[model samples]
Target: IISPDSVRLENGTSLCSGRLEVKSNQSTQTWSSVCQQDFDQQDAEVVCRELGCGAPSVLQGVLYGDVEPPMRTTEFQCGGHESALLDCRSSGSDRTTCSPGKPVGLTCSEPVRLVGGASRCAGTLEVKHNGEWRPVVYSDWTLKTSAAACRELDCGSAVSVGEREESSYRSVWRIRSDCVESGSALRECAAPDFSFSSSSSFLNLTCSGKPSPCWDNLQL
Candidate 1:
């Protein structure tokens, strides 16, 4: 059995024996014993919280042990019109702690200039998790993600990606990416996953000139 935070076994015992790995806060484990004792599957669990040892003394004289879960990172994708999500506060250090139920939400609704345009048009992309909107970080914005955005917005060819800082931003999620292009239908480009750190703050992208603009922008 799997719990949201930790694992447990029968005989009313708290087992801390081996290593386990979970992704997106979801994981599974298999149990098989060579002993002659009958094992109860109902008492075994991959629990999320620490079980009280002094509650009722479940393990009086039984062979039981537990192992810590392995650390994992979940990768998320960004679309052409959407900026990728980021954990701004770095609040949740563990993947299991940052469960999929608590995923990051990002949105981009500000009008931006494509390539070199006189008027700035904009669209917004929002991530829904735990019922809130968190803006995407622009620090690690990639051309692929930006290109996808341009294509999604029918904003012509992607020429560059830029980041801007705003003081009054609601969520401290004010990373802005600028795309430059022409036309009405934005072309689709493969979005890539980017890491967050001090060194990778600026991103630039150049699109392929396919004369007819064959990229699929309708599917989003």
Candidate 2:
């Protein structure tokens, strides 16, 4: 999911978690890592937002394999709300050296939400896109599938994963267990189809306590 944003994460288990890489504005087009010292929470926020993900959960250096530079010499100064990382201000001068293996490795949380419930952990599941939160309809989903959502929400183990019958049909996102099992963020998982239907059910979860590693180890 390399976007036109000229910033990307590499050497990660998935697109949502990886080593930070930025494309050079040079005519020939090169990609380089950013010094961890040069990037911050504000920069991390913009990177996550630009990539259509939740907030930055982890930022560590050398978590991704140590790669040497051809790195960006300038420091990024993001205001914390830019649409793209490149949209931020850069230092006028070049940094001569960065410590070895000090480039950033970042992990962004999944863009999943729970609404209309008693707590942040319990509610109808929704995935975000463009700006609006879209409810999802998942016929093939299970507790295994909801487990990932719990992890994303920082909720405990998925106590119950079920559906509630709604009175009317409306447009909602469609999610599949296979795609979610592949472990992509709900929005990043392929196109979670959006359409109006009489499915009459919206996916729901009641998450409580702490999450279980068992959910992570289950087979689909």
Candidate 3:
């Protein structure tokens, strides 16, 4: 089965933007220019949506860098509404036609951002997963956890943490309180085995303007 986590952009400045790549045969692989050249706004839309990004903001020739030889090539006939790239009609054996150049690159509207709050930097936390915006339920939501999120969003440092009842938000992922202390990336700290559940509880954060540097970028 193809998991939502299997699709991602690598070698870019952020998780929401990078060189497009897909996982296959228990390994991750990059697509050649054949895939890039074939991609249009429609294909970019599906890829961005599947990665839980807001929308396709930018789709063009390689912005990250070049992929070396032995690259995987595929042709996608996406209807522009598929949930995953693999769901599109694809064929992978046409490597000979691919041009030798940088691979495809994409950028989403906002891969991670704050919402239901006063500003872009403060609000109930929501992260995109599986082409949906889901809440983050920290069993022990704390300053450290909030800090991690703030760092991820480039929203400075966490000053305080609070809770609010927001019944409309449902969470498909959770972060164990203990996982925060290890300084893992917010996405990395996420517990993979949990399923989605509807809940009203959410963490509210206040962060400092001088954000710290952290890394843990995933498409979903």
- Among these predicted structures, which one has the highest lDDT? 2
lDDT of 1 by residue, 86-155 (tens): 2112224333322222211111121222332332323233222222343344555556556755564445
Q: Candidate 2 clashing pairs?
A: 157-211
| lDDT tens readout by residue for model 2, 1-220 | 3355587889786667799888876676877888888988889889988887777878788887888764655799999989999889988676767888889888877677888898878888888766667787758888888787676567867889888888656657777777777776666664555566665688888888454233222110
Best model per TM-score? 2
lDDT of 2: 0.76
lDDT order of candidates, top first? 2, 3, 1
Clashing pairs for model 3 are: 156-211, 166-200
Order the candidates by TM-score, highest first. 2, 3, 1
How far does residue 33 in candidate 3 sit from its true spot (Å)?
6.8
Look at candidate 3 and tell me the lDDT of residue 163.
75
Model 3 agreement with the true structure over 35-93: per-residue lDDT tens digits: 46656676777877776666776676657677665455666788888877778887555
Worst 10 residues of 2 by lDDT: 211-220
Give the TM-score of each candidate. Answer: 0.23, 0.81, 0.63
User: What stretches of model 1 exceed 4 Å from their correct place?
Assistant: 1-135, 172-220
| Residue-pair clashes per candidate | 26, 1, 2
